[model samples]
Target: MIITNITSQKDPERVNIFIDNEFAFGLFYSTKEELGLKKGLEIDEETIDKIKVRDELQSAKSKAYHYLSFRQRTQKELEDYLFKKEFSEDTIENVIQSLSQAGYIEDLDFARIYVRDKTTFKKFGPYRIKNELLQKGVSKELIDLALEEEYHEEIQELVDLVKTKYSSIIQDKSEKRFRRIGGYLQRKGHSFETIRKVLDSIDGKDD
Candidate 1:
């Protein structure tokens, strides 16, 4: 096969490679230089096959980087993202290995950070945090460790939240008010027992 032509793509940084006067593949401009590709260069069939694989790998890596730019992703999240984009399994695996080696995708770290954000900023309870982490593909053991580490102050956090949300009704002395407080706490991830204790204390039932 002959490399008959190479033209700039709309992206400018990429070029359309033509083989035997037909569009064969698109490659990054840097790829052209790295591969020493040029017009009228003769390439064997096997070389063409290798070039396609290389190009796909490069493309997959670029896409992964862009996907991870906004926020960290769980390993499964990155794999599913690349898979959904139609990258070959081998390509996705290689890209994942590279990203992991580069410290871009660490499930343990991602889990820890996620738990911190949800607890400190989102004010979510242990149940909700665990569910979210499980959905993100974190392992059960890691999720357990993360929740254990972050949930030590759960009781205080729930107390603070209910106090603020029902500040005007704090001393309303109504069963409905107690149920409302307990429901809000339960929805936020606190267990029913925890909610009951907090509500009981709020209503002076503990006295």
Candidate 2:
């Protein structure tokens, strides 16, 4: 087929490629330039298929990079994002492999950083952080390793959190007050045992 036209899309970086007076496909302007595609240039069907594959892979990588620019993402998250964007499995796998090799898609690093941020900034407990990582598609082994390496539950910090945030309930010194305090901590990702320890410390029951 002979190339008939190359019209720029609304996106300046992209262009619509027409072959034999029929709209063939859209491709990156760079790809068009690199391949020396122009009006009346003769191309074959096999060449068109190859160009489409290359263009799709490039497009998938671009989308993945943009999505990751906002924050670190797990492989599964990127896979889901690319799937939603209608990229083929082969393209998705290629993009993922490329990103992984380039050190842009490290689930273990993402998990470690996530754990540190949640524990330090959000004061989230291990359980809640674990659930959040799981939801983000991090592996169980990586999550456990990250939690072990990064999660240092400062008893004093928990004490301060309870004393400052739940002082009213603490002052009540009733079973109901204990239950409420425990519930709040539990929701914050603390285990029942840790909550009990904190309550005991608060109630002068800690030895």
Candidate 3:
């Protein structure tokens, strides 16, 4: 843990620190005066260890931020991901906290966005979308709120999907087309009553 080299760059206000022939970390300060970068200083083993810990924490935080940039992830999902990358538990927790503070890893926000996207774009029913969110480790409370708030949109979207899939066949006079379409909607995760109602609306059938 020897401070091998320290290089400063003017354009970006950054200092690159090297230890034992390995690049340890970079420090960014508003001005050269911030870090007191005077000469004749000896960095001992304890200081080097502290710097290494800080470097590792920054590295882990960068990794977590990049992963979140690609897509939203549940808390458990992120924990598993960081664990797989061999980050220490303290580092993982600190990185996760930083992301949450930056409005990145919000489970409730994720659940709401998931439901909205599923209802609007995927045209999935509440049951299917809710189950998917639950599988992603979303809590039941947010799932319930998502379903309750988006029920009408969810139902309409499912109905639209069923209609688009079976419009021509449902118009036929054959009962086979009706039953097949009903079963299709049911298998798509719509409730029985909802399927029946949507099917009947398209076919002008009683009950």
Give lDDT per model, in order.
Answer: 0.86, 0.92, 0.71
Q: What TM-score does model 3 achieve against the real structure?
A: 0.74
Worst 10 residues of 1 by lDDT: 149-158
Residue lDDT tens for model 2, 1-207: 899999999999899999989999999988898888899999999999989998999899989999999999999999999999999999999999999999999999999999999999888999999999999999999999999999997776888888998776777877888788888889989998899888778778876
State model 1's lDDT.
0.86
Over the stretch 1-207, how does candidate 3's per-residue lDDT look in tens digits?
455677875736567777676776676433223434333445677765665567667667767878888899988788888899998999999988888888888888788888777766766677888888888888889889877776554444565676677776756758787688767765555777887677666656634
What is the lDDT for 148 in model 1?
Answer: 74
Q: Each model's TM-score? A: 0.89, 0.93, 0.74
Provide the global lDDT of candidate 2 against the true structure.
Answer: 0.92
Global lDDT of model 3:
0.71
Structure candidate 3, residue pairs in collision: none
The ten-residue window of minimal lDDT in model 2 covers: 166-175
Off by over 4 Å in 2: 205-207
